[model samples]
Target: MSQLIAPHGGHLVDLLVPEAERDALKHEAAGLPGWDLSPRQLCDLELLMTGAFSPLQGFLGRADYESVCRDLRLADGQLWPMPITLDVSSEFADKVAGAPRIALRDPEGVTLAVLEIADRWQPDREAEAQAVFGTTDRLHAGVSWLLDKAGPVYLGGRIRGLTLPPHYDFRHLRLTPREVRAQFDKRGWRRVVAFQTRNPMHRAHLELTFRAAQIAEANLLIHPSVGMTKPGDIDHYTRVRCYEKLIAHYPEQTSMLSLLHLAMRMGGPREALWHAIIRKNHGCSHFIVGRDHAGPGNGADGQPFYGPYEAQELVALHQQELGIQMVPFQEMLYVQERAQYAPADEIRPGETVLNISGTELRRRLHEGLDIPEWFTYPEVVSELRRTHPARHKQGFTVFFTGLSGAGKSTLANALMVRLLELGTRPVTLLDGDVVRKHLSSELGFSREHRNLNVQRIGFVASEITKNGGIAICAPIAPYAEARRQVREMIAQYGLFVETHIATPLEVCEERDRKGLYALARAGKLKEFTGISDPYETPESPELRIDTSEMNPDEAVQRIVLKLESLGLIRPRD
Candidate 1:
């Protein structure tokens, strides 16, 4: 008999068919209707097929879904915190209705599995948000996804996996639960502790994990999520490189590193319990539950979605039932007097402690500031620097929004010329008229079409920013929501500066350079901004200029000054 603990619920559930049966299923799937899996669905499917989410045969049926949402348990009374459902668009749901089975395809159109449909329903997203994440506010990233990004309908069924998703990068470290358990048995690791993290591991994290392992007297498993985490997080490629460098610091043979392709919901306490269950299934006896584990930061009210110790408390409450012990993460601090690290509660008062927060570290990286050796390894810092270069060396986007005839194009031209004069980086100007003619020639001025056009521009701008080039965009982006979406898209790669040309409608009409306002006033043009259509003003922008009071050159100078202050450009000597 194996010395390691048994899989959750007495056995691991493997959805993949036997090797002998794969050929038959593959042939049958070709004639069936197919649903392309989204990124989150893909992650869930992988875990389901690999037995990481043991006892879950496939997507949750309506009964289990409602039970999981309301009571954090399945209809069978199993301890399942998160709901695992396959959401789909309404059109796909209708097409697949009453079908015996449907193929599940990846983005590349390769069928990975066949789902035998059992139930379908439209989820009450608001209720699910309140029950699971404790909030329905869009400021929460998970809530935003539920409300805005998720499909309208959910389909539940049993999945017959043909093959796991192909991962070309880091294949060795991506071990399934069964493979991980086999390794544990082979190494005779009786008791193992799992540390789950989505962020890059630094000195504090290293110390925390080391101490956790020592306290539990167990082998350490440094398992980080490589799938979709919170937005604006460091890319997994960079994070994995950092993890590889940090692992060498641990005692040889005491630690192992693995990657979990988990699409995190950032549900705080509930997510903590779910993680503990997952680790238990992976042959771990102890799991780390940190302060604000899986938290999605603050809400729209500027208050944290979950308390600091809520996750730890929740995990501890179900420790025995989960078949895994909860290891509470203690905040580590560097002591200047002793030149060593100590836990927060163990440190003496006024001993000159030092710590760097994630925000502070990001600021340092953004400004090319130094990150001391005590905070992280030099190799990790080098990898971070390669991805997040100094602000002046990085690409950025400057977006100007205002009413038509507000001198946006004029100011954009002047700013473009000024930036070109510096000759430090290649600059691309995407004026409203120019984009309308070339990129969005088929698009109309309808709300949907306009938003689509703006999103297309945002996509292009994001690409430019990602490639270390500057993009200057000038458009009558009257809707705040569309502009906000553009800002988010650009911000993921580099800096996004929103400049509001706050020129009044009357002043814009007085200029009337394009005769657009005249046409709108004469009722020749319909659905025109500042006439028939509303121009939702920006609540807060990086810079706001009213051309009625400022000239083009002066406005451009102010923008340049703002960029310099933001460290995107160096000041003249």
Candidate 2:
């Protein structure tokens, strides 16, 4: 295991930051809206400061030195790929394995450090090569020595694990009018519209987007987010493929495609402005704004952070300022008979309508129910089916609802291993403890905070399920209403199975892993669930296996059966 360095002296293999530049780095990051780097991130920043990864350095140096400055217009330079970040745990593994290089730095024609591409790492040779880097007199002793001795020490900072937004060359950002106009001239279309969504393409959404294009008398650019979108949202690979399928429906030689690898800040109004700014950068004259653009979560009483029109209105407010036009519409509700998208303003009263949400659409697809072309095109459905074959590939919310000491996490890990072997579909397990550690780091264990805590996990799990993946959640999810809210969110994805591991309070109290239950009984703890807070187990869950009565294996077996019976898990593919 790669050791986590505490606050102390630096080790080798470390990215060293001069004290002079540390404040400057933090200041630059702080200048960005809604950005905060953690302590470990500060250490990582040294890599950028030390010239290990100067994403914009090359663009700034040679390009500017050799050529006279162009009128800082759109022709300033060509576009380049956005900066990239590798997940910490994933990168740690790659470093230990000595993964093959996907890209490398060259200084004065001399090779420097190389990096492995996150998605494509052929582990065999690298894994063998990594042996010399570990401890003892092993071949990897040099690497081990560097890691132990040269790594930077944590000096008490924030977000020690989070990655940073990339610093890219501004010169290589915008799409020149010359290029875009050239394409427009080829296609015989003057005006162009862009459709941007961090979602899988649904019929209602397509109707809205395509209608915007048609209304603008322009071709469509189905641009999707391929970066750090909402956590638990469909991964870009599936969403991108889904877009490819739907784009096939557009008239040939008219529409185009692109991907935006931008991370979401979860800032509502500011997010709209940012989206408009980016769309402008991509040579889009106009953008489609939906209600609550990029809303991260709800507010005080389960209401969304902003009203539906608030995001759109924010764009409308800044439309001229940002140099982009906005097409804002109410949330599109599907009309079956018309079988296409229509403005909510145009729909007549008394039309028999099914208010199918992205959630319901996901539910139907996950349960193996056939979807009509009216709701979603055959091509898109085919793509979804490829990932989640209706009946055979059901996503799951493996909820572990028990007291703290009831061994929920242990069983969860074992279940994860078993499901990994069955690996026909992706699985994400959200343990309460783990979620608390990673996501709700700022919150404490207050009752209100507990709700917020589970809400975040539910949101993530819901995203996973929406994108055709399994979610295994194990929280007390104590309040029935809170649990219901989570269910409603995951319901958007269709495969929401709540497995309540009902162990008796006495059993849980006796096995208090944290001794909190014991303290609660001894009057040392207050507001503890099952003692003061009361946990209402699912009265009507899909599966209610009593772990106190049945063994873990038997409980898991029963849970699997419930899955099979519900058409979530099926005969071997």
Candidate 3:
């Protein structure tokens, strides 16, 4: 008679096969058609198999998908806010058509489970975006991923798990719902409040979460989402180190830490409700809903996708039905005069309050500025610094894009030489013609192939930037979408400075160093940018150099100044 809140839908669903059966299933899976899971899909499958998603046995069929999207409920009326789908390429869908089961393998080709296909169909993604995220804007990270990254068809089936996905890091903290429940039972703890986060925990977060537990009269679970969160978020490795340091400051026997491999949709209100259900399944009796929980920042119109308090309100409405209490997160502020932290609602009108925004903290980190002791622990700050060193010490990419013969390569070469002169970090030049001959020799001048070529350069540049090296890229990226994608990729690891060589097309043709313009004029070359194809000028580049107005030496100086201004390089006295 253990008395933790019953798992969502009354019983925890364990999809893992018995040890005796695993060997047979694994053997059979090798002969079946296999689909390698993407990172997000792997997260979903892990939870579904381990009962973190207790009511879900497998990916949703069309009926359940439609039901959840429309009303935030399954076809049978179970409250499930997010759709758990297994998206596949059209080729895979066609290859496995009419198959009773398909093998689901990890990226390393290890068989993890067998999916008994009950349904397969192409979903109307536009409708899904509107219903789940309340927006059709691609600027919304969730909507952007759904439209651009997800596959063409979705597979729905019951999963017969042979084993859980392997996680080499944080093995001790990755607990299944059953394991978490057993821990609660072992500790004689009944009421537990779960705090969901994807960011590093600071002093303000510590106070807020402690107050939340006190209000709920329960133990606290510092559960963080380690799966796919918003892009540009602090990497999980650094954030986990911060969490580990912060956890030691909690009152003994009052809190514990666990990791959740959840692929968050950043669905705001709906996502809040979804989080509550997940905590409920994890044996928590209370769940914290913060301001704009899981929100994906501003929309394309520059308005918030969801109101600040919308998530709290939605979770409060369903707490009773969810069998969990909603613990609204109170904004914590440091009162300088009182020398203590206080909730925003309780602080006196005259009290001098202080708080550091995430943006401000990042700025301080970038400039190697001081972070006050009152804002965060020294241990946590040390972890952040270890990963994010000051901008001048970190790696970065300088990407030059423009029309042919716009002096992009010359500028890049000069910049590389100047950087190498400083002897600070290794510099690699990825010139367009050089990369084409070495990296993308098979690619063509078609729009798709051109975008792929630029993406390949971006990938290499990002790797260089990640390894504390400078990468100078010179390419005629032309398309805005491709450039945007490249910027996003490199930005994840280090600074990405886009320098637009805004030389006029007439000047570029006149230079004609490679005779490309002459061939395009004679129609010998098709899909030539600035001739037959379009070259979308960058709306906002870090530096706009008109080579026609200045020599390559002067253009390189302008780029060096731009980098210095950004604190990526030291300014000369």
Candidate 4:
């Protein structure tokens, strides 16, 4: 046990000697003696300054230290040292859910630059920040300068750049077993159990959590992350409040709720292991590790960050290493018959409760529609509605994925026109060709080149979505992995409906409409999808449109349905 939280060999023990030696140790550990903090230690320190600020400041800083300031900028008038939380060093994730961004805008609100801070600098801090933020100023120095926009430049982690939503997501959200246990104990409640998630709270989440608590005879801790969660994540503060509101539905004596500010590394099993350990520290007696705990996902160009069940399996393997007992959960699907969440296998073949998603729910809330109690309790929906306000707040984007010459552009324009007619929200269509022209002007059409092109488009689309504008993207996005990756990313800001234009290869070829197919056949085109190379259909598109089967008007209507299903639009009056 001493080793578990033990101070290390030579200096860690020596540093504990007395206050006279503390300052010397602090300087030496930072400089000559070289006591590099583990990724976890660094992360904890960051949280000390952010989440546990009051307590930590009292301990670490002089009594005169008032509070901490978040954003610090540079000479260029940009928020220079974009904040770095622990998520990067630990999970080494590419994303942090609900992390707020420092919009690099002038006084006019027109964006000139945007900053996104990832996990700790991979190599030396200087070179890495230079590469990521495109500047070499140490973040600490930038912080000392104070940000340009001034006035609490939005704390929390970063999901997207200036192009993202207004609120920082719960990018480093965490809830440990120890914390849960503490909260529970304070309330005189024992048998604490945590509900895990990578998404905002929805009816399904509610149902499952309720069931888990009831079955285990434990008080529920609606624990969710603001870490590297699902891309289109609800802001952690909002979700935390949402859970708080939902807690009222539970027996007051049987439920407790709190927040966890932890980073996501997107390292699947390791992520689950990390989660369990954190929960143990939080004093939770039991933690529910579901199908995929802390699964941030991987794009088409990369392998899945981890396997399905990999997280659960890892938790099982490390059960002995943890202080918390594990509560293994099955994939809970919405059961239509009961109009509640149930284990996927428990559902009758015919039951259906308007199967939908938190993603869809957010869309609906944005559009200002009444979410049925069958889907989520009125209190929960109200919380979401208040936070998201959908079409009114900065809206999100529409991204289309299909083959070249598959009419993605035509359909995107069609959707854009319709969205424009709906009024209010601004729309930006980032066609693959146009985006390539902007981002990859110097590059050619190679596989690696194409991947970069779509990635750039995805980033922009995410920003548009974050800003609450309708960003429509028509990228051939041939790789299934790449399309999925883009979808996950855009999800951070808004809805990402993978509209698979399942226009048969034959149809696309015949349309060679651009004559590109013929060129590919004749070797005039290289890396052309469905030609010398290939195109992978989406594993399960949110909505599959057959441009070959339906008229453009019909396609648009189908799209409207898709948007409605996703809660992006209210039913046409």
* Top lDDT prediction, candidate number: 3
The TM-score measured for candidate 2 stands at 0.50
Evaluate all candidate structures by whole-model CA lDDT and list the values in order. Answer: 0.91, 0.57, 0.92, 0.56
Whichever of 1 and 2 has more TM-score, that candidate is 1
lDDT per residue (tens digit) for residues 4-24 in model 2: 221111111222234465555
Query: With candidate 4 superimposed using the best TM-score fit, by how many Å does residue 492's alpha carbon deviate from the native?
Result: 3.7
TM-score: the better of candidates 1 and 4: 1
Task: Tell me the alpha-carbon RMSD of every candidate.
Answer: 2.5, 17.1, 2.4, 14.6
> Candidate 4, 254: how far from true, in Å?
15
How far off is residue 291 in model 1, in Å? Answer: 1.8
Candidate 3 off by > 4 Å: 1-10
Count clashing residue pairs per candidate.
0, 16, 0, 51
Badly placed stretches (over 4 Å) of model 1 are 1-10
Summarize candidate 3's per-residue lDDT along 1-573 as a digit string, tens digits.
012344332577778888888888988999999999999999999998888887888999999999999988999999899999999999999999999999999999999999999999999998899999999999899999999889989999899998889999999999988788888888888899999999999998999899899999999999999999999899999999999999999999889899999999999999999999898888899999987899899987899999989999988877778978899976789999988898788999888999999899999999999999999999999999999998898999999999998989989999999999988899999999999999999999999999999999999999999999999999999999999999999999999999999999999999997898999999999999999999999999988999999888888888888889999999752
lDDT, residue 306, candidate 4: 50
Model 1 earns a TM-score of 0.95
The candidate, 3 or 4, that scores higher on lDDT is: 3
| Model 4: lDDT to the true structure | 0.56
